[model samples]
Target: MPYFSICGVPNCPNFAHAVFVANYLSEKLPNFFYKKIEKIPREWAVFLDELNRENKWYTHESPVIWKELYQWGGTKYLIGGLSEFWEHVYCYYGLESLIPKYALDELALDNLRFFADKRRSEARKVKNVAILGAGQLNSAILIQDLLEIKTLRKGGVHLVFKLYDHHQNIDRSVFQHLNDTALHFNSTSFFGDFNLVELYSSAEDAMADSDIILNLDDYNPKDADFGKHMNRCTIRMKMLADHLLVAAKRDAKIIFAGSGPLCYMATALSKACSEMFPNIVVITADKGFPFVTAASEETGIEIHRISAPVVWGSIGVNCFVDIRNAFFKADVYRPYRCSLTAPKGSTLPLGVVSSELRLMGYKIKDAGVIERKVKNNTKKMEDLIGRASLFSKLRAIGLLLKLWYADEVGDEIISLGVRSNGSFHVPKGMFFSQPVKLSESRVWVPYSNYPLKEKQTKKRIKQCILHAKDVFGNLGIMYDPDDGFDEDWDDYSKYLGEIGEGEEEEMYE
Candidate 1:
């Protein structure tokens, strides 16, 4: 009955960060393989074992034997200093599955220190971690971390993991590496701090009281159409909605996310979750901080934005490596178009996100939004939207703006909101992206009629709204554009409305 969760059918990076956190706990339990790479060739074990005994972490210098050991394994090493330290951690712990890539560095280590201090302040530390559909290299990396780790959390709850993989090979292979689990693996730092339990249950069973639900699967976008993807995503959401009513505890967070192309599935999921679980807050997260700009919105200010999932994943994975002032560290802005691989010279997985963040809130101007408030002004990035077909861009924006208002329940800020109450003379539910800044985080729209500064922005917003009918129709939903009420649509609907063909004669009579 412990709290456990999955965000979505996330890909490699998300899984990796989950594992990074799962096995990472303060030195209170048996964590022999914490930070160790598993499933290594037998050839290098003895060499690593002997070398590990002689190394100490305090030295800025790499051990003389580290290079020779690297050649013995024929590894493609990126950072030599980091490689040496991690190799030392692995050999000392008597564990495997680590590659040269996932090593510790100064900045990453500093981030860890900051994270530990933050976690230490929390009331509860250890919690249950469940990974759903984990079947990639990230899975392997995660099992290693969950099986053992070093971390400090607020409530002193060292995270334990319950991994779910349908494939026999994946489950069996990961299970085999956890042989030491029964006996409780040994590590100098975590000799007898706490106990970790291994849990295995059906996905539905684990949903009960889960603090998080990561919806990271069903990413197939049919015929390159997001509406098609939403069709599939909607089915899944319906199932989850039914299941969660009886299973999920109140306040559980469900993040509809994944890798691959920007599909409308997440958008649909957001809408579906809100409709299904009125009491639960649904969040959209990804391990990637995808780049999106409000510059073209014709707004007063344009600030570069990264969604929450990416920021969380980046810090989670970094703690697996080293540390830094993560509490105040807005991770380095690494732009990735799309892929599993990290940027060059970095072994951490690619930063990913659902891009569910399309609004610019007034709270952004508040302190702590920018990790340390280092910059005086927000930096602008070239609209990475890149030129795309009109329909594609429209669909993309829908996903970005999905649940924009709903997600800001507690932290409400002025944002682009839709016309729901007919305050704008637009159709009751027409797409209306207005200045929805909150008078306060809890306040909803329309404290005073805040108007748009530019006509072009309004036109652009109107077009996006008009196209929603198309997006809806693609998903087998119908809409009569005439029912829509916009300045342009009103004139056109009037032309097409109640008047018969060539009615000018009747009018003259």
Candidate 2:
């Protein structure tokens, strides 16, 4: 018995002929058995090349046939292509014409139609991800991360990246590089049925039908003066809010990844689109860098071992890295142990371990030292490169996105700058970075399980609220302190007494 395998492009005439002949032979001869494999026309050449390499044969073209020699330990015997298969059948089994020319043509045409329809269906299922600052380093890094994600490589919903950047700032070379990478991935079948990476000259076109929008627009201020820098950021944020309001989909999740006042920008965006796009959630991803850095340094653990440390308040100077609820792998640090002994290879809360260390007379660096370290490192990188280092920030954004899309994070908390609905005793309608967990529906909500009872922590959060108000006032963005708060809500104004105006100024200085 000869077990035959036939493979070719679905739309090829020879494929139809081969399929017809195989079916006829199987029906007439009990000893004959065969299976047909359909490949897309674009992949036919690669498939043929792979087949040839594996079999040590030089055959090419559609409808390549081979037979399994069952008696010879299931070894494969090359039977060549459609014409060769016909000759083989004629020589061995005394069979000649099987499929008519009209039938072959009709079958091939039908295959072509089916293939076209399938491609159209797949295109419709592909999700569009729009990158507003397509040429920037951060955008490039983010795209690279997206391409390497293993879930996307496995067959599922495909992605079509729509890249848009200012005409003068757009880097065509970067786009070409990303396109070439995608093509290489396709050639190797790394990305199954992936779509194209398109560059859009118009923002509106780029944002159309987009499932996600990553705002990586470069707003790094070149001005040395504080007032001038504030003015530049204000203008850029206003322009971005306007563009997003007009172009972005009402349901789309807009991520603000630009280097500016992230909390303020997210607040402005949320406020601007609140009425028309009420479901629109603006996520500021800048706080991830500081949050991770502080956690790793405090725990004396590897960055990857640190799970989550919440960033409370604004993103930059006013932000406080709260490790109260953060956890790290206990196995990473053998010497450090909390008051209670935990099983090996378990996770431990960072705050508990830090407290144990302090009780044991081991000096732990204060929050001010950790904050200074982050700021100094950023400043040093800027001084050397003439621009702010984006690698840490890029990693932060990637981790945040991963957490956002993942099914669960267990007890780990993620720090995100989201508009406050009066959670954490902060003023209503203010954009503050708080300890948050992803809900069952994948929405980020304030993590209220661990009460923020630390008096010092509460006081700093109040100061942050004041600083945020100052920033909004300076930028001419309106915010109501009492908005969105319930009538029974306790007076948050009393918490501000602990943070003096001079102390707030000196903290940033």
Candidate 3:
């Protein structure tokens, strides 16, 4: 009827031996029971000291043992260290087959690995994601996407979404409904156990220790004046940037998802915190363009198969989609064969053909059809949402986040608003939407050598850059033409065919 407690550092040889003996005795003796308590090696000394002070015993090292003599009027008995326990068991139970030194060392090594792996597993399970201005509809869609996406389910990651919005703006009922949905899904779905949604009263509390911060703040102005909108957006962006500087970690990615000049806002935030600029990004609405979606619907091809349709310039205005290098994988194509009936020396449009996959470059002749479809779709979306395609934008954000979490950056090309490192003819210190490949390190590298042979493409890109500068100057974030002459401004002015008095006003407009 003896009950014992064994305490020691987790990976100690003596501790392993003590545990082995205790297990052996508990199995043979029907009335015997024991408990094992493990402490890390660094914390062992303090624990051992406290144990000795409480028990009035002077014992050092690991494998400290004690017996509770509850059967005999609840008296406590100290049994000293590992050797003493071994001797007591040997004399009392007549057991003498001691574990070999090498075996005990191996046992300790196994315990060390187990402890290390357990710590790593715990670290991998918990991921903190902060959503700023989470009361928006797109934010709700994003939350649902994160919870239900199959790609995220594979990692066994427990997602903690910390939602923050202003007191007047935030919807508590929406949060309550989402929480109820999460609970219901967690019981029914296989991977929904890993999802959790939390609401925070303060922005600082929500953003603290966040691995990914999504800025879904609704900053678009109701005013029709573009200049006034930019000015208001600039003021709000600066305030958010200041908050992020104080609360966000150095490595946490701050993704801007607001409905404004996305590239300019991202650039302004990046300039505010230069050291963390690389981690700041804006998910572009390139893949969500009406033309891209129309192509998918027309050809019956999955939108993901259509890759590398570069969206250059900014998000809303002065943006251009280049499909010159776009490739699509499909099982069927138009019934035009490259035979003698066709033009002489015409070859197949296929790039890579295999048993499982056939990748083909998009034909330039289909551009007219796609353009018409784009116009139709654009008009429909504008009529519905007033120039804001909420569903498409939500899908784009969801897709980007899925790819980002999966970290399987293959040959897929995505358009992201990232800080320009003077690559792809984009100016440094500005955020521009360009075709980029995600590296294994999770960094988005712009395709610097991507060809821009078409004169119109080049001209459009130049105009976008100028428009970005004008917007920044109007908001007083960076540029100021009235103060003094700048090198980039002077150079762009000369390149754009010597702007006249009337042309200057038109360019800004």
Measured by TM-score, the strongest candidate is 3
Per-residue lDDT of model 1, residues 1-509, tens digit only: 11112111112232233334325522433532222222113423453455445543222222222222222334322223434434544565443454233443332344446545764555345555444444322434433543333331223455544444344255676555443442343232265554443434466665665654544333545566655565666676567666666777645544333332212333343354444342221112211112122221222333343222111111110101000101111224455654445556766556544433222332233223342222212222223433211232223222332333233334332223222334433334332333333334323343224333223333444554445545654564334644545565556444443444334224324
lDDT of each: 0.36, 0.66, 0.70
Q: Which number leads on lDDT? A: 3
Ranking by lDDT: 3, 2, 1
Off by over 4 Å in 1: 1-201, 222-229, 260-276, 279-452, 474-482, 485-509
Error of 2 at 287 (Å): 4.1
Q: How close is candidate 1 to the true structure, as a TM-score?
A: 0.36
What is the C-alpha lDDT profile of model 3 across 1-509, one tens digit per residue?
77888998878998888888888889998877888888887888899899888878898878898888656335559898887897888888888776789999998888678778987786668678898767654565677777776666566667778877674335667667545544554555456344476767778888888888888776665888887777666676677777777887877878877665778778767766645646777877544356656667666667877664677887755676665435566454335344436665567553334422322222344555776778777788789876556676677777777777674667556788887776654667678888776778877778665544444555667778777767666666655423332455456445544324233224324
Clashing pairs in 2: none
Residue-by-residue lDDT tens digits, candidate 2, 1-509: 78889898887899888887778889999888888878886788888899889889998688888989665337789989888899999998898875667888999998778777987886557768888776666455577787665544345676777877774246667667656644544464444544456667677788888878887776655766766776666666567667766777776767767665667766666665545443333344454456556646675766765555556777643666655435445432335446257665667652322221111002233656666777787788789999877776677667666766655545556667766665766665667788767777666667755444345666677678777777676666655643543332334434433334234224324
TM-score for each model: 0.36, 0.59, 0.61
